[model samples]
Structures are given as structure tokens and as C-alpha cells.
Target: MTLALFDLDNTLLAGDSDHSWGEFLIHKGIVDAKAYGKANDAFFEDYKNGTLDIVAYQEFALTALIPLDSAQRKQLHNEFMAQVITPMMQPKAVKLIEKHRQQGDTLVIITATNSFVTGPIATALGIDTLLATEPEIIDSMFTGKIVGIPCFQEGKIVKLNEWLSTTGHSLDGAWFYSDSANDLPLLERVANPVAVDPDERLLKHATEQQWPVISLRD
Candidate 1:
């Protein structure tokens, strides 16, 4: 069986999943409204410029996720699915997913976005498998700590290995798609690495290596 990995933020849709999650936190009174707004804006800016590293972003997101009660977090997750996910899924991305599904590939959404937040999006997209950064929880509240490695940069590969071990799969002949320099480790480990609307560093690497490059999203 083949594995097709997708980066959840820009490559799949127009915005960052972390931003959406942060918004949900405030909308649900899980975080300070003004603080959520500021954090999301800063994160979006750095993410777009390729300056925000995944590990740091995960840490920030965990802190943001901490204030919500478990029930509130659960509700936010559901609301995000209904609002953020249902509308933001792109036609082109769906098409790509369909094409891979036709081949019976096991699809996975691997991202630095929190698994609690991104899990519903994956389910909404009909992706049953997810490899994402998970937050530690205590007494039904976010502990401001990550449970596993941050699912970015080399962490993507580590998360993938954990997923494979649990699911009995490997990276031998799988395909991975991403749009950032931080996703390089995942792109390199897979048999097929497609850079979709990659940033400068990834674009340069794709050019030097003659890797297939496409503006999957604009």
C-alpha cells in the first residue's frame, strides 16, 4: 500500500490551522480574546514568511490551548470542523486527495498543528490517519506541554515513525507533499517528494534537485 502525506496548513488550504485553532479558543472563551487575536496574527505573519519554526510554533499553540476546559476544547474542535474546515477545503486539494484514494493509498495529514485541533479537519476531509503534534493534558486541560515531538522539521519524520509503528507501515515507497523548508526531512525521507508552492529555501532545493514543483495553491 502507498502512503500519501500532506501538510495541513497552506498546502491544503489558504490559512494556517494553528490560527484557526487559536481563534476557536477565544470564540469559546478558552483564552483571552485580545491575546488570541494578537497571537494568531503574529503566527500567521511568521508562518507565511517561513520564519516560524514548527517546534516553536507548537510550543506557542500549546500555551494558547491551555486555558480551555476539556469540554470547551472539545466544543471548539467540533465548531472548527463545521466552520473552519468545511469551507476552507479547496477543490484542487480535494481532487488530489480523490486521485490518491482511487489508488487505495492510506492518506495522512501530518502537521505541526495540534492533533486535538487538526484531527476533526482530517476527519472532515475523510482522512482517517493523522500524524500531528499532540499536547499534554492534565485534569482535562492543556498542560502547556507537548506530548510527543513537534510535528515539524525533523519532528515530522519522528512523528511519522511513531505512526508507522502503530499502523504497521514504513516509508519505503510512500509519497509526501509539503510547502515549506521545515518539511524537508519528511520530503527527503519519502520516495516521492512534491513541493507545492514552496518557499525560497525549499524552492531552491527543489530546483537544484529537479524535484517536481507545482503551485498547488496560490
Candidate 2:
């Protein structure tokens, strides 16, 4: 089967889910506005400039889930799915996914965002397969630590290869769509790489590589 991998944040959705989730929590008073908000903005800026430290940012993002119980976190995620993520699903993205669905490819969303936040968003987008950063848990309580690879930068290629090995698939003719230069490793690995509203770094890379660049926004 052909592989079709997508980057979730700014590639499919109109906004960055990881950053937006932090904003949502701050707005709901789940996180302190002044400190959390400031740090979140700084991390996002770092990400845009391709200078983000994934390990540090992951700590900042996932730790927000530590205090809440599973039920409370689930409820908040449900609210996030409806209020924050749903509207960000661009119609163009849906149609593009549908096109690949009709082609019967093995569709997967390989995102750097932690599973706690991105899982529902993947489901909402009609994708059942997701390879995301896993949050550690102990006795059903989130530990606010990453369990395995962060799925950032080159880590995405490693995670995807592991997933492909278990699923009996190959990236021989796979397609990967992403927005940031951070994904350049996997983007280069795939046979068909599409840059979706890419950042400056990725746009320049795509131009040099002559990869197809498309926009999934109005």
C-alpha cells in the first residue's frame, strides 16, 4: 500500500495545535496567563525560526497536563476538540485527505505534538493512525514526561520507520506533506514531498529541491 503521511499542526490545520492548546488552557485558567502565555509565545517564535529545543518545549507543553486528573483532562480535550481544533480544520485539507483516501493509501498523521492533545484532533480529521509524541503515564496519571522519541526533526523518521516495520509497509513511494523545515528529514525521505504553506526555511528548501508547494487555506 502507498503511504500518505501528514504533519498535523500548521500543515493540515490552519493553526498550531500545540501552541493553541496552551493558549486554550491559559484562557480557561487551567494555566497561569502571564507565565504560561509568555513562555508559549516564546516557544512558538523559536519554532518558527527553526531554533526550538524540542525537549525543552515538550516539557513545557506536556507538564500542563500533569495536575489534572484523567477525567478532567479528557473533558478539557473534548472541549478543545470542539472549540479550538474543529474550526481550524481547513476544507482544503479535508478534501486533500479524502483524495488520498479514495486512492486507498495508508494514511497517518505523524506529529510532534503530544498524543494527549493531538489524538482527538487526528480522529476528528478522520485519520485513525497517528504517530505522535507519547506522554508518560503512571497508574493512569500523566507523568508530564515523554515516554519515547519526541518525534521532532530526525526523530520523526525513526518513529515512522518503526511504525512502518510493524505495519508491513514501506516508504518506497510514500508521500509526506509538512509546513516546517523541522520536518525536512522525513520530507526528504518520502518520494513525494509537498510543502503546505511552508515557513521561510522550508519554502526555500522546497524551492531548491523543486518540490510541489501547495496551500490548504482560503
Candidate 3:
């Protein structure tokens, strides 16, 4: 079966879940509004410029969940989904995913955001498979540390290759849709690379490479 890989934030969704989660925490008074918002914006800027240090960013992002137990985390995420993520979902993106499903392609959401955040979002999108950065957990509590290679930049290719090996899936006829230049590494490896409402850098690269550029936003 052909593989259809999707970037969760910005490509499939209208906003960045990681950044929105941080904002959500601030709105809920869970984190210091000024400091967390400043840091979150900085991290997002780094991400856009393709200069993000995934390990450091993960440390910062996952640290917020350390104090919450599994149940509390789930509740908090549900609120986030209802208030933040729901608005980010786009009809065009859903149609794109449904199109792939109609073609019998194996669908997967590959994102740098932790599984704790992206898992439900993927399920809500009707996708069964997701590959995301893993937040370490012990005894049902977050450790605030990542357990494996982060699914970012070249790390995305490494993580996807590992998943492909275990699932007996190959990149043959693979289609990857993404919005950021950060995804160029995995984008280059796919059989079909589509840039979805891409940033400035990715737009230029996709133009030069003759990759299809499409937008999910209305």
C-alpha cells in the first residue's frame, strides 16, 4: 500500500499545536503567562527558521506536563482540543485525508509534537497511525524528558524509517505533505512531496524543486 505521511501542525491543522498548548497553559494559569508566552514564541520562531534544537525544545515543551498526572493530563488535553485544536481543524485538510483514505493508502500523522498532544488530534482526524516525539513516562507520570529520537528534521526520517521497518512499509509511492522547511529532509525522501501553505523558505525550495504547492486554508 502507498504511504501517505502528513505533518500535523500547519500542514493538516491551521495552527501549531505545540505553541497553542503553551498558550493554553498560560490561559489556564498553569504557567507564568509572560515568561511561558515569550519562550513559546521564541521556540516557534526558531522552528520557522529551521534552527530549532529539538532536544532543548522538547525539554521546554514537555516540562509543563510534569506536574499533571495521567488523568489530569488527559482532562487538560481535552480542554485544549475543544478550545484550541478544534478551531485549527480545516475542512480542506480533512478532505485531503479522506481522499487518501479512499485510495486505500496507509495514513500516518508524523509530527515533532509529543504523542501526548498529537495523539488525540490524529484520532480526531480519523487517522489510526501516528508517529510523534515521545514524552517519557514512569508509573503513569510524565518525566518531562523525551524517550527516543525526536521526530524533527532529519530525526523525522530516522523515526519514520524505524516505524517502516517494523510495519513492513516502504517509501515506494510514498506521499508526504508538509508546510515547513524543517520537513525538507523527509520531504526529499518521499515519492511525492507536497508543500501545503508553506513558509517562505519551503515555498522557495518547493518552487525550485518543482514540487506541488497547495493550501488547505480557506
Candidate 4:
């Protein structure tokens, strides 16, 4: 079966989950509103500009989980789902996923966001496989550290290769959908690269390369 890969943030969801999670923390008074929000916005900008320091961003994002136990974190995330993420779920995006599902594609959500923030979002979308940056855990608690390579840019290719090796899956006829220029590396690797409501840089690249550009928002 052909592999169907999706980028989780702007391509699938209407908003960025990692940034929203940071906002959620600020809203719940778990983090300093000014400092955390500023950093969050700055990091998002860095991501957009393709200048993001993945390890640094991961450290900042995952650090919030270090203080909470798994149960508490789950509860907060459930609330986040209800309050923030639910509205971001787009009907067109769901339809696209369902269309692929009906075709028997191996659906996967590959994202730079940590698994703790994205795991439930993937489940809510009815996707079974998710490849996201992992937060190190010990004794059922987050250690606020990454276990392996941060799944960003070229790291995505590395992670995908590692997964492919064990799962017997190949990129033959693989399709990748994404919105950011940062994903150009993997987008270039896929057999079918679709830009969903692409950013300026990605739009320019997609146009020049004649890649199919579609939108989930409209």
C-alpha cells in the first residue's frame, strides 16, 4: 500500500498545535504569560523563516510537562482539545483524510511537535500512526528532554527512514502534504508532494516546481 503522510500543524489543523499548547499553558497560568508567549511567537516566526533551532524549541516546549504528572498533563490536554483544538479541526481536512483512508493508504501524521502535544490530536483525526519528536520519559514522568533527533526538516527524513526500515514500508508512490517551506526536504523526497495552503516560500517553490497546490481551509 502507498504511504500517505501529513504534516500536522497548518496543513491538517487550522492552527499550530505547538504554539496553541504554549498559549494554553499561559492561559491556565502554568507559565509566565509575557515571557512564554513572547518566546512562543518568536519560535513560530523562526519556524516560518526556516531558521528554527529545533533542539532549543523542543526544550522550551517540553519543559512545561516536566512539572506535571502524566495524569495532570492528560487532563490539561483534554481541556486543550475541547477549548482550543476542536474549533481548529477543518471539515475539508477530515474529508481528505477519509478519502485516503477509503483508498487503503497507510496514513501517518509526521510533525516536529512533541508526541505529548500531538498524539491525541492524531487519534482525534482517526490516524493510527504518528511520527513526532519524542519527549524522554522515566518512571511515567516527562524528563523535559528529547530521546532522539528532533523531527524537523532533514530530521524528518531520518526518522521516516528509521520507521520504514522496521515496518517494511517504502516511499514508493508516497504522498506528502504540507504547508511550510521547512518541509520542502521531505516534500521533495515524496513521489507526490502537495502544498496545502502553502506559505509564501513554499508557494513560490511549488509553483516553480509545478507541484500541486491545494487548500484545506477553503
Tell me which residue pairs clash in candidate 4.
none
Residue-pair clashes per prediction, in order, are: 0, 0, 0, 0
Candidate 3 lDDT, 57-93, residue by residue in tens? 8999888888899889999999999999999999999
lDDT of each candidate versus the true structure: 0.80, 0.93, 0.95, 0.95
TM-score of each: 0.86, 0.98, 0.99, 0.99
Per-residue CA lDDT of model 2 for 1-218, tens digit only, reads: 89999999999999999999999999899889999999999999998887889888988998888888989999999999889998898999999999999999989999999898998888888999999998898988887788888898899999998998898999989999999999999998999999999999999999999999999998
lDDT of residue 138 for candidate 3: 93
* C-alpha RMSD in Å of predicted model 3 compared with the true structure: 0.6
Candidate 3 lands at a TM-score of: 0.99
Model 4 TM: 0.99
| Superposition error at 123 for model 1 (Å) | 0.2
Candidate 2 segments exceeding 4 Å error: none
What are the clashing pairs of model 3?
none
Candidate 3 positional error at 43, Å: 0.7
For 1-218, candidate 4 gives per-residue lDDT tens digits of 99999999999999999999999999999999999999999999999999999999999998888889978998999999999999999999999999999999999999999999999999999999999999999999888899999889999999999999999999999999999999999999999999999999999999999999999995
How close to the true structure is residue 169 of candidate 4, measured as C-alpha lDDT? 97
Query: Can you tell me which runs of candidate 1 are displaced by over 4 Å?
Result: 24-36, 48-56
- Candidate 3 error regions (>4 Å): none
